[model samples]
Target: NLSVVVIDEAHHYVGSLGASFQGLLWRLERLARHYHARPVIIAASGTIANPREHLQTLTNQAFVVVDDSGASQSERTILFWDCTRDPKTPPSTQAAYLTRHLIRMRRSVVVFSNTRAQAEYVAMAGSDRSHRILPYRSGYSAEMRRRVEHELRSGSIRGVSATSALELGVDIGSLDTVVLNGYPGSISSLWQRLGRAGRTDLDALGIVMVGGDPISRSLLANAAELLERTPEHAIAASDDTDILTRHLLLAAAELPLEETSIEDGPGATAALSDLVNRDLLIKDGTTYRSTKQRPHLGTPFMEREASYEIHFQGTRDHRAVERISIRQALREAHKGAVFLHFGTPFRVQRVDSERREIVCIPETEGHHTQPALFRSLSQGRILEHLEPHPTLGIERIEALVVEQVTGYKEFDQQGRQVAKRKVTSPIISSPAEAVVLTCVDPIYLGIDPEDLFAGLHALEHALAKVLPLLTNGGTSDLASLTLRNGDAPSIVIYYLTKSHPSTMITKVIHNLHEALSLAEHLIAACSCASGCPFCVLDARCDDEVIDKGAALALSRLLGKISVGTALDSSGDEEG
Candidate 1:
């Protein structure tokens, strides 16, 4: 019999992970009811702003939060290293140099990167004869991860570059220094990563290398405000249709689900009916049973589309290197792309869609590949609309997004474009949820038509980078598209996931006014005479259309609109 359930690192209970865990808790409660036993849940979180509320949302039960710590405290020093001050060297290069310096000081250090590719790049760049820094991320093989863990514990490796995968409560011995390559999405995450060092009573040092993103740059300018700001709230929609559907299937397989056992929400009822219609569930005497054996086997905790297996082509036999999601495979493991694993480069030879496998050969060349993508969005139904200001209108819509990988560009070891080749790949199209921003008239900004479009493009780029900081989501979680509807220009900020309801987008809509204000500050704070990667320009943007002055003008015009004001009450001319 279960009496107490302890959830460690409870802040991770957000997004799909939180939804899956919530479903498990629901089942556990049902089982306990059958046995007439009640279990007390104790959730422990370090850096959540609303710990009690977050846990309640996760488990559907009330919690009494104990915020104070009883353990001994360690003296820690957090130093902010602004990368904008030193623009001559790249941020990654500076990170590698700092990692090497920290290792030379005989202090064990962990350098945290925002992405897996950046981790690998830092590890490869920081490796020297005296010490070899390795990359640790989610896509690596379990065996390789275990080996790295063992090495780190035994002090065999003094330094490592990793993504947020290492920020959790993993036992990887004690660390002396923590280097943040960039601001990790939110304040809670930033503090969580900094807490990785000095687990014991030993004094620790944390270095944050601010990147060129709008959020990071803003934090750099207002360091005091950032330090004093409260952490963002964590959110998870347990009643989301796609998430609920998967969990309901798993619950039915665990024990026959009755009307009394499940919540009678519209989404739940529709999911149940859809399952029965698809022959995945059988209805018998007011109960539903899964037709398939162990339905949980097919459902993963994390929501993802199809996946592709990467295999190393050895002389004698092929060996599985790692498995990657289909989206990542399209961008990184496309045909003729150079894939890096454990600091070793592999050139992809073939991407077999039928077999769902990517075969690669070890490459001795020093080059990288980046895919060129084209994205388009079709008309969608508006679910809600709000006009915060007379000139600005925001709408939540459901639409279909089509993404195509047109070709790839090859870059040499010196970060110079060496060649560009076209490749034939399947188009990816799926349903998405988006928040569209429309202006009453583009003429209000008094900018040329060409520059108006360019400013809109720049604003979209800046918003995509800045919204992640406010939404508690990553840059990959949201995407932006600019559209011109006659004289009015609209920017569509949509989720990257397919057919899923995300609280992140909801937060974006609620905080759209704040986001615009931040964007305006970011554009004005930038020292560049025109647009640059540090402000409005995106490094990933292949198009060369961007205008900083025009974007600033448009942003100022939009920011003037009062939030929460009704469109009818504004008494302004509409487009």
Candidate 2:
């Protein structure tokens, strides 16, 4: 019988975190029932905003969340380091400079980078110091990582640079400073990384070095939300049909399920019946057992691995395993593409989609590879519509996006494109739910048809950059699409999660007035003149389709649109 189970870094149990934990938890729950020993589950995370709700959904059990550790919080200072002051220098360079300064000041610091390459770069840049400053990342051996941790604790290592691999509580001792090379994407991770410093009532300092990305620039401009707003809530959709079936089958294999079995929850009855129909299970009286003594059942709860094993030439020992999703593999693992593994470069030789692996060899030629993708909206349907004004309407839509990685470009260290190649691949489809806004009569607002498309497209791009403020998702979790519906210009923003729609994002969309107001504020607050990446132009948008003046006008118009009539209509309809 299981007495206790502890899940650490619990926030990662959802989304991209694959199914091993689900299988383990299912077995433990059954064991507790059979042995009459109820094991206590202690799920731990330092950053989740809604622990109680997230735990209930993850484990299908209620929990009494204990957020109070009784440890008083230490005073902390957060600084936004705007790299725009010196546009010629990269954020990594600035971070390296800041790290060196902190080391000189005798402050124990940990610098966090979003990628392994940046981590190594920072560590290398700061190696000039006399004290021990080292690079720590997942690629390092366990013993090596342990040595670094030990050195840091023993006061031998003065500073360390690392990726998110060190974000969890790894007992590195208290730090005096944290330098973020880029926005950690989510506020949860931002705070968690900062928590590494200032432990045990010691005052600490946190610095965010603005990267080239638009999201980082936006956050740097409006720094208040990063510090004052509540961190995004972590939500899980554990009612996945495939996951449930796998757990039920495992339970049936473990013990015969009877009518009164605890395994027979609300949906378990239907699942078992389906299995019996499929001949995977047999019914004897009221009990169910596996039809095949050794059923070829696979673990379905964990994420499937469609990854490439990068091994050193002439050696069977694998250097690293780059676990990528099917969609990411298609885009990132094409032949001739350059892939960076733990800050080291490798060029793809072949991609065997059937084997679910990419074959790559080391490349001494230093350059970064970026995939050029083409996307089209396959189909769309309006599920609901709220006309906020005579010319403005908000629509809830279900859409399918078809995308393909057609080619890739290589950029040298000087940021100049040097090579380009095209590849043939099957299209990838993503079905999503979207919130679309339509402007029926743009000319009525003194905007031309061409200007309307450009303006709305620009608005769509800008809104997506800031959507993470409303949900537990990052910029990658959502996308924006702009298109023309007959004569009207329309823009759609949608979530990418397949399990369940993010209610937080949808709620913000439902209140279009507030969303538009916030979107306009972001565009207006940008320091760039006549629209730059910081304001209107998104990396996804076509330069031909983005106009800063028109976008600002469109944002202003959207903000002024009166939803009073729609509110009254909705109220009367409810009545």
Candidate 3:
């Protein structure tokens, strides 16, 4: 019997599909009840709001909680540092920046990037200037990651940057300072990642770098407030069904599954027998087995990989092959090549072979070629037809994604939402509900041809210090996006469409939207009198400098435009 339980990355385990461990969080709660032990859960996170509630939802038990405020309240500084998006974050620059601060400290420092790619990049740059600084991520073989962890323990490695893999309960000895290139997505994630910085003998010195993304900015700016705030945790429903179902079959595979009355479930015995008679379960004496005839009777709900073969189209040859990632496919797609695939059946909109991309908006249901995730968010499912101005776990959830927050919002002396600026935002993406959409782009994309060239260059500079925000889904998926050049030519946009329905698509669109909007919003809100912090465009990129009004205008237009079918070069929809 375990006396204490510490759920490190506690924010991750809510929905049914999140992780198998999520099931464990639920099961542990049930086990506690079964054993009549009142569980105590102490969760630490970066800026995830409502720690206690998040706990309650996961454990299914009501409990008391304590909150810790990091000592850096007055010193919790946020900087709007600038860098090239192509990630010209030089090792020399990073090393110089840190050496100035922690060179004197005894313990080392840890840097975090959400993705393996960025983590590798930052680690490489740092190691070039320093001695024995290592890169830690899961992409490397288990041995490689283990070696990195081992090095951290021995102190041969002076500094390290890693993916979220290191954010959990792994011990990396003690550290002096922790730096984040951007605000981690949730409060819990933030604390957990930062917790690795300071420990035992040293003070917990954790610093966060906000990527030029809006979400990152909000998380960084209000993290102290967010950290100090209560977290709203939700529980997954009907989790025990899987447990009962699995054990029932396990028992059938071994011995006769009968209600011994010791099992406490009454109708379970009759239910299994009835299922056998109905041809759902096959009874071989006291044991029951799923009918081979039913094919999927004993299958797991989340269809494991090897279920489908992805086919990606080659731009140069116009030949369809297996699915590839955006960074690879976009560079390869031929100009004006058509993008199509079969995740859930989707109608092709437009394709850019040149950009190696596709643009699509969701079509009403035809054939769900890609699987439809359960719409887990209330705003997406319940509150439709209203412009949402959500507080982002603040005063209230109004907009799904906030663009501009206003109305001089003031919190009373009691730290409540008294009155404040009515924050306007784009419908924000929810971590819970994952939705799918189809989009298309034309031959030249026609949004702004030159900006297409320039924006790519700009993004590298834009996201220099920003965290990679793949909120809606994964980063390797196909995507469609609009861009602008400095009076070089008309604005152009491009998109890549994949037929499969995966979270990758959502991640692509959300990251693109977040990247452009954060830059545009900060630029527009600031390029005014006194350069308001609210709109300081404080992020690294000065999108407004490139085309201030145009960027904001484009972002707003995207929010309002209803998604439509993609138009072929001749402006005809693909049949």
Candidate 4:
């Protein structure tokens, strides 16, 4: 019956966050509701452009305004050094530089890297610092991570580099600073990590190192917009039947979860029992359990260890528990070294692959080595223009593109190794499915020849914000591609999810006709046989952009479209 909840990374579990953000969320909500608990959440996510309506719908409750706190310190001080001229400003180098810089100023620091390998690299480089550098993340044996935390608390560590595991409130000790190596990719992430700083008796210092991307540029530009803007808010999820169904089976593993019991959310207990009527659950006595197969917690990503165990000279203690990953292990121990464990400067002589241990000895030299791969970011150039060629199509004139990615590839898709692509991005413009509504003029800002690419980048930023809403309901894939005519250009979104385009075909057709009806009043050129930007669209459009004005008219014409989904069916879907 816990009414209060704190949902960290709420955005990650939405219907359309990842390939299956919705599926995971449905499971979470189903579990909560089954126990007669509804969370009034203090939810967290990256920057939220819209908070009020988002949270109200997300949590399924009438939510009132709470403290919309500004970022604890300066709006957000982002520094972009010109690294293209010198590739030495790699994540690892910059991480070490930030730590040393802070330590020089007598401040404690945390380095947030995008991956575990990078975190370990940074930690290894700073091994000799008196405030020992600690590598923290989810993958290390619970024993190892706990030991790391203990050293941090004792001020035996100067810096702790980590993955997202440290992003939450796992306070090892208060630090004077935090250095974000890359954009954490969301508003909630930025603020939550920033919260790690300013925790000391002294005012904390915060620094964010930017990766080269349009999103990163936008964040750097509007560093203070949130100062006058509302605080980032959260969005919750509705119940999902798939999750409920899964829980129905798992509930049997604990105690019989009977239909008509008072444990389910709202009217869920009775609703769940309908499955028994359908023979999904078998009723015995007053309780009902799954008629299906057994529940599998499955194997964890790595060797599962005690969540909070630390061994010190054969003695052990416990700390926070979390999932371990390959990324976390590499990030924490890549440049494995031995520092003073109990008075002696330990040496990590070599890493044993099979044992997952770094062979170490007392340090023979003054310095330990953590190799860094330098990548450049501060290649911030102004946008020139867009030129179209029939062969290459539309190309960006000037933009900040990833020139050469020099790290080990972690995830590979379509044969391109992830995080290793020498990605090049132009001030790109693509088309999105539009609604024909002219009620509000779409906001357009002038692009200086130099800033044209930046404008395109800002749109890229805006599109990311808008696209998440459409695909987030959970059952789908979200992607986009570029669409350009001989003269015009736009983006074509391929949103494949639970949303079926076939279902709304009729209303879409009617709205298109309404758009055609308005072409005469809107413009005569729209009716011309020759190609013109303004016109009514049919099904097979090269650039599938629906006019917003025409769309709103159609929306008013269609009224509210309700999708009734039963969350009590938790049976998982087959591919």
Best by TM-score: 1
Q: What TM-score do all the candidates reach, one by one?
A: 0.77, 0.68, 0.45, 0.49
**Candidate 2 accuracy as TM-score:** 0.68
- Deviation (Å) of 306 in candidate 4: 21
TM-score of 4: 0.49
- The TM-score of candidate 1 is 0.77
Off by over 4 Å in 2: 15-27, 60-62, 70-73, 100-107, 115-161, 200-202, 211-214, 259-269, 284-286, 292-297, 312-338, 347-371, 375-575
Candidate 4 lDDT tens digits, 359-449: 4444544332322233211212211112111211111111121222123332211112234322221111222222111111112212223
For model 1, the stretches where C-alpha displacement exceeds 4 angstroms are: 69-72, 84-88, 211-216, 256-302, 314-320, 369-373, 378-400, 404-426, 433-440, 444-479, 484-488, 495-575
Over the stretch 1-575, how does candidate 1's per-residue lDDT look in tens digits?
88998888888776556667788888888878778889999877868788998889788888897766564448989888987677766677689888988899888889999877778767877888988898899987778888888888899998889999887767554787899998776678888888888877778999989866655666677666666667766655565566788888888888888978777788789999989999999999899999988988777777677789999875343555689987788778888888878866789999898889999988777666778877778756666667675566787777778877889988655445789999887676777778888776566556676677778888888787678567755455678888877677788998755535655567788777788888999899876666655578664565667788888888887777765732332323222
Q: How well does model 1 score by local distance difference test?
A: 0.77
lDDT string for model 3 (1-575, tens) is 55577766565554333334444554455556556776666665444555566566555566575565443322223333332232544322353245334633544877777654345445543443345456676534566668777877787766777778787557765566677765544445666776675555555566665444444445544544555644333333322333344335444443334444114463355556556766766766555565543333554644232211223333332433343443322222212222222111223345444444444433333211111111112222211121222210101111121122122322221223333323222121322222221112212223454333333333332322121232311111122212222332222111121222233323333354455555555445443432222332323233433333333444443334433222223322221
Error of 2 at 91 (Å): 2.0
When 3 and 4 are scored with TM-score, the better candidate is 4
lDDT of 2: 0.70
**Could you arrange the candidates by lDDT from highest to lowest?**
1, 2, 4, 3
> How many residue pairs clash (N, CA or C atoms closer than 3 angstroms) in each of the candidate models, in the order given?
0, 5, 101, 46
What tens-digit string does per-residue lDDT give for candidate 2 at 1-575? 56788988877665323233555576678768788998888888778788777777667688998877565578899999988787776677678778888988999999999876567656765667385568787646677788889889888877999988898758565688999988776678889898888876678999988865655656766788567756666644343344556666767777886756645465567777788999888889988887665453554445443444444342245655545566666666677777655445677787776676777787777666778888766546555656767788776666676888899888664345788988886677776777778889898888997788888888877776555544434355567788777688688777554544444335446456766777788788866655554567664454446776788788889889764432222222210
